[model samples]
Target: MPPTRRFRLIPGAVTVLGLLLALGVPAARAHGVRTEVLAGPTSVVTVTHDDGSPLADTPFTVLAPEGAGPFLTGRTDAHGRVAFQPDRPGAWKVRVAGADGHGAVVTVAVDSAALAAPATGATVATHHAHEHDHAHDEAHVHADAHAHDHAHDHDHAHTRDRWSGAIAGLLLLLLVLGVGGVLLRRRRG
Candidate 1:
């Protein structure tokens, strides 16, 4: 093949490789999730994916400040929610595990004042403590099905924005490729 012909295939091949890589990126990524807490009459915890989907029916364990073991153990409801009544004011830890090896530990700080005024519909502050943040490594099992827990003062808009950003990125990639193709054709013809 002539030098020009051989080099002509380069741009097309590069574009093809780039497209393949871009398309495969999402599929190769592992799913990530986060958690939120609502402290009211009962301390409620909500677990959700970064994309804002509920992780329904997932198992959760709540550890009280005074206990060596779980204070309450159960699976999240369809909305990824589980609740526990704190007997005392302290830091309560809620560990939620998904089926696919993903989970989060949320630390909720409960005050005596908050517990005392539960009738006021008060919400408690929650701390994000991921599995990696643990002092010791603990083996966890993830659930395949989805579970979602409802809580107060949690926003779902962030998830929608994330999806929009991804779509915008794909559109931008297509625009760049189109312009490149046009320039290449103009150069040849």
Candidate 2:
């Protein structure tokens, strides 16, 4: 009786061990897909599996040229593709993939000018454009202000207030004229 019971337990244990091996091996998928854009006005890159299927739901990030924009974060759609504009206009990179396991990265090279980053740069030839001098905001750094930056936000509120004041004055004048016209009409009638 003891031998029969032990033999039954052996079959159950073997079944469990087989199940673990079968599931665990492929479950740890260290495999992946990657994509990138080549030669175009629109900076684009794509990633796919080794089999060419779109790598869906994967996270992607674009590190634009210095002083271009903040790190752009996006996920691949059904087509396993994402896009972001570079910060400046030289050697840029687009990193893509996820880390359910290890992860993957894709880098694309394109010539771009980062007019926002505060660096020594010549636009075309003789004229050197240094952007940092005029950009006085403490929050803006060298990388961001390389191109035409948001240094003029100080004037944004001022402009809005000036326009509001002008609009209000116009509305008041129109309201006064409307009231006067109504009164005149009533008197005439």
Candidate 1: regions farther than 4 A off? 1-30, 124-189
Model 1, TM vs. native: 0.54
State the lDDT of candidate 2 residue by residue for 75-139, as single tens digits. Answer: 87776666554444565566665676523565545454433433432222101122333523222
Query: On residues 1-189, what C-alpha lDDT tens digit does candidate 1 reach at each position?
Result: 799997988898889866875664443322566666766447778787654567789999999998899999989988777778888899888999867788888887888876886353546343332222222111111332322222221233443344555668877997999999999999999
TM-score of 2: 0.38
lDDT per prediction?
A: 0.66, 0.50
Per-residue lDDT for 133 in model 2?
A: 34
| Candidate of highest lDDT | 1
- Give me the displacement of residue 95 in model 1, in angstroms: 0.5
List residue ranges in candidate 2 displaced over 4 A.
1-34, 67-69, 112-189
List the lowest-lDDT window of 10 residues for candidate 1. Answer: 132-141
